[model samples]
Target: MDVQSETVPRDARHRVERTRARARYDRDTVHAILDAGMLAHVAFSVGGQPFVIPMLYARDGKTIVLHGSIASRLMDELADGVPACIGVTHLDGLVLARSHFDHSVNYRSVVVFGRARAVLDADEKASALSRFVDALIPGRAAESRAADRTELAATQVLRLAIEDASAKIRSGGVKDNPADLALPYWAGVVPMRTRYAMPQPEADLADAALPASVRRLLAADEAAA
Candidate 1:
């Protein structure tokens, strides 16, 4: 698959049936959800046993990059080109409805289906690692020390092409039946968000200031807020 493509083609596996109205197949929507999420739950099977593990990931174009210890069983299995499913979700808010059965949480989520492959090339592996750090904090890779040969050798990077994917999102106010709305219950949405606190310098650093990358990240967060 060409990872640089514009959009992911949707099929049966990528379809969202439970809440079909919230399904989104556009590339922009899928990419936005993937970019906003920092963690993913990777699911796969080995010897008929299913395994799901949480992992940090970065999206580069149409591929998702993940890394782990070279000796890890999950990494080894994924590097071998096994089929996998990657899921990411971001909680937006809690919806409180007049009826308990009508309560729900607003969220944005994405599911990707693809075959994982090991990134063996030295340059490509290094680039993927850099992307991981930058994804957490923009411009961080250039501000920090580069990974040495020994460290790179101990790590394994895997790339999964975004071939079949879909995003589902639910937003805005509570949905309640007319009869339930007349009850003496409050209904509203409690918004939620993730924020970064002020950076604390290392204990060993006597008076060192925060790095430009970190400062920039904090500034961006504040601006967004």
Candidate 2:
């Protein structure tokens, strides 16, 4: 994987014309945004009507994997190689400005455009499912029991290659106009963050201690903070 590709080719569909200064085409930037995000919005058209659905996703090298029930309309449409757009965003703060027009959010976002197809191979599908679990919490898949044949058969997994992708980021204090700076209104950023709370155990497992995998996840969160 070329994390520092000289340039990511842009097209009309994936180009970021507005706020061009914030556009990032490097693979590293795009991958970082995608990896940090917990949810993604997948958009596609069905019968000429556009639909956007939120999904849990995992990035594998240059591709993204998403899973759902086998009978889902969105999964069925995506598996047919329909063109789709996947977007993930992480809000960092609220940027308050002196004027309403200058107020905005500090965020990192990525948009990927490609055609997705179902993962039909048993081995590939199983590997993708494991990746999905591990992506949420490292080593979690190894701690849990592997999915059985019937469970695998009931799920539909789709993979979309990140052919055309771009990340846009905005940070720092408010960008109020020079004239507005003289105003008496306060202008600054209110930082926001997401953290994991203490885990609740099942009532039946009162004797069982917290799993090492979960402890590791909590430790990682603390270290990050």
Candidate 3:
């Protein structure tokens, strides 16, 4: 693990004001959170009407890759180089405290600010699509059939470089008032996790056996558990 203590330079837009101790501007921290997440809530506007859409995305180094149908309004609008804010979050636990005011949830979240540009080149678009697949399950892209020309043409790909980003995280036990510690209420953290269950194969592919990517995914999940 490459642990970098250097943090991203913060300005008014990317700085954390409230609970500043929970804020993190390190590239490694932000990247880790983005990699762990599968969905991104993208905030943008069209003709002054604001919209926030949930999108599937993959982090490629300093850029985030997104794909959608070419006919999609959001995709078309973003491709024209509009400023956007992308957010990803993971709920880690329920923090129960002696008082309701102190009750909170342990989470890791990131916000990225950038402008997205359309990926026009065929080869670059194809590689971007592959990254999305591999991000979900390592090596799955190579095992699966590649997208055909027509399919690739119909799909729109966009890349948003990480211009400014910040991560906010909360972890560990409850923080209850010292006086409230004597209260009868139980206080602790109930950890939460997202894990993969056994894979269910399609009936048509009966007994075909699982691919190496799936097996590897399951093994990694089990090891983490």
Candidate 4:
């Protein structure tokens, strides 16, 4: 399969109809959004019923990896090769406009289209799970113990290739009407961000030192802040 970053053919399926100017197809731009995101809302239909569920995901080259309990119906359906739409979003700020109709939000979001397949091979599934753990926090997979046979057997890992995708982004100041500028109402952007608080340890492990992976994550979060 062709990598989404290499070529994302734009058609009615993945087009941004509302605001065409905000649609972006560049490789770096699309990959950057995926890399920054940790959670994705996956939408798929079973029979005639539709479902949208939030799941933790990891971007692995051209595919997104997700795992769940083996007995979960959602996981079973997705593993059966159902067509899925995954969405990831990061809210940059709240756009406040003088007029309520013009109020909007500044965000970076991506919509991906693909069919999911179950990772049945033991080694492949384990590798995918490891990559997922590391994606959340770099080096975490190495710091933690590997899953045992029983644990691995109870989990279902699925991979969705990025067959077609597109990113829509809105940034900068609030877009308010020129006439509304002189109004008494305040119109500006209230910036928003996700930051990590001080780490909390388990009650039994109160004296344990912070792991290398956690220290690195804290340092990165602090630098970004």
Q: Which candidate gets the maximum lDDT versus the true structure?
A: 3
Q: Which of candidates 2 and 4 reaches a greater lDDT?
A: 2
lDDT of 1 at 18: 86
- Candidate 4 worst ten-residue window by lDDT: 1-10
- The TM-score measured for candidate 3 stands at 0.95
What is the TM-score (0 to 1) of candidate 4? Answer: 0.95
What lDDT, from 0 to 1, does candidate 3 have? 0.90
Better of 1 and 2 by lDDT: 2
List lDDT for all candidates, in order: 0.87, 0.89, 0.90, 0.88
Residue-by-residue lDDT tens digits, candidate 2, 1-225:
223365687778778999998999999889989989769999999999999999999999989999999989778998899999999999999999999999999999999988899998888889999999988887899989877788889999999987788889999888989998889999999988788988988999877888888999789889988
Alpha-carbon RMSD, candidate 3:
2.6
What candidate 1 gets wrong by more than 4 Å, as runs, is 1-10
Ten-residue stretch with the least lDDT total in model 2: 1-10
Candidate 3, backbone clash total: 0
Q: Per-residue alpha-carbon lDDT of model 4 for 6-80, expressed as tens digits?
A: 556667788778898788876677778999988999999999899999999999988899999999999999989
For every model shown, the clashing-pair count is: 0, 0, 0, 0
Model 3 lDDT per residue over 13-67, tens place: 8787899999988888999999998899999999999899999999998899999
Q: Is candidate 2 or candidate 3 better by TM-score?
A: 3
